[model samples]
Target: MRTVDFSPLFRSAIGFDRIFDLAEAAQRVGEESYPPYNIERLDENRFQISVALAGFRPDEVDLTVEQNVLTLEGRKGDKEGRTFLHHGISTRSFKRQFTLADHVEVRGARSEDGLLVIDLQREIPEAKKPRRITIGGSSQGNLTQIESEAA
Candidate 1:
């Protein structure tokens, strides 16, 4: 396995720790392929994630988000007394995690037809949005200057 050293980049970057953590997470989570899922871009700021969970009920699955990470978990009952001729469909437990970008929020989630769909939207706050600043504004005199006391 190959690993990258991001120590040098840490000195010059600010507020980019999440990106490095995400990259490290992606590298570490490249092996598992159980319980396949899909991600879709609905629009400019809208997105969706569809996870295939056949033979699993709504109560058996769980979804949660914390610290910009979305987690999906599925728990299935044990097949102790049941006998199957051919076990094709997977009814096993699974766990999936997704990293969310800044300002992105989960709108809702629904389970329908054996698929769990999660809707997301990136809604930037009004104060964070970009605004055109006039080069020479007429409110220059409105600025307050700091007073320094001599020692």
Candidate 2:
């Protein structure tokens, strides 16, 4: 596999280190793919992440948002002295991290029917939103009105 150099990107860009970090992570191979999840856009500013956690209970899962990073962790309880002939469900511990955009917040999280649903919403401040600038009539300098000739 070909390797990408990101040194040049850092020399010119500012406050984009997180983006470069994500790209570097994608290039790496043999990363964990357990605990499958999905991200859906409910609306223009609403989103939901659904993670399949069949054997894990609500208490075993933890969700936290800090510094625009959302982390989800699950610690499976030990199965004491139990032997299964055909064990299919996986209850392994897993940790997942998601980087959220500016102004995006974690609304809530709930578990239902073996699925863990996490809701997110982007709330932009009023000062940050775009507003139309009224172009009122203004004269740069002293302007004399010219009399129009009657037709």
Candidate 3:
């Protein structure tokens, strides 16, 4: 297997320092293999992130968004009442975080059939969106006409 260098791809050409932080976080993510997850794009502007949390309850999970980072944490309480003959399943606590873009926001989170699903949507503000400009004449001609009109 070949190792890839992702530093060049994250160069600050877009004037955002957060992208570099995201790249560093992504590198740290490759070291972990516990609790698999899947990310799928539902539509042009919608996305879903699903993680397999076999023994975790809905209340045991926490979802939060802070400083453009989405964090998902799961903690399983201790089973003190009963003892198991064979403790095969692992119920370790875990925390997973994902870096979100500037305008992206979390919609909601729900659990179904041992799977934790998180929904997210990107909403670009009207003023931040790109707008088309109309150009009628050449720059020099327009400048000369404006100057004549002013005189």
Candidate 4:
């Protein structure tokens, strides 16, 4: 059993029930540890996910993102009439998922050196970003009445 520390989120987050839902989903997908992967943060807004697929090809893997969830599925081709002296490398099918924070989006994906690399980014919209409001001088004296000409 892996212990996850959620104290960080508990400290500053409020009204975030989806996070806990994702945690429950992770527990349900436990102990299928194959085709190891890594998640790296390149900067504040950019991230990269690398999955090690030793014997899998680029076309065999599929990636999908929907409603803040990123899913990666790998399908290995069937082995025909070839016999192996020592069975070592595993090309088993796997479905890995990741819960993305708000504003997070999948940028692109590629296969390189037996690894599937996926890029992601968090882009907050202009309307959602914090804005600095300029406090102007009192509006009471700024209001002027328009002098009307004689009809």
User: Residue by residue across 44-85, what tens digits does model 3's lDDT show?
Assistant: 678899999998888888889999889888899989897899
- Please provide, for model 2 over 1-151, each residue's C-alpha lDDT reduced to its tens digit, 9 standing for 90 to 100: 5779897999787988778887887887457777999999998889999999999999899999999999999999889999999989999899998889889999999999899999999987665665545444784444333343211
Model 2 weakest lDDT span, ten residues long: 142-151
Cα lDDT tens digits, model 1, 1-151, are 4989887898887889778877877888757777899999987889999999999989999999999889999999888999999999998888888989878999999988889999999987755665444445565633332333211
Clashes of each: 0, 0, 0, 0
The candidate scoring highest on lDDT is: 2
TM-scores of all predicted structures:
0.79, 0.79, 0.73, 0.74
Model 3, global lDDT: 0.77
Q: Which ten residues in a row have the lowest lDDT in candidate 3?
A: 142-151
Which residue pairs in model 2 clash with each other?
Answer: none
Q: How far is candidate 1 from the true structure (C-alpha RMSD, Å)?
A: 8.5
- Ranked candidates (lDDT, high to low): 2, 1, 4, 3
Q: lDDT scores for all predictions?
A: 0.84, 0.85, 0.77, 0.81
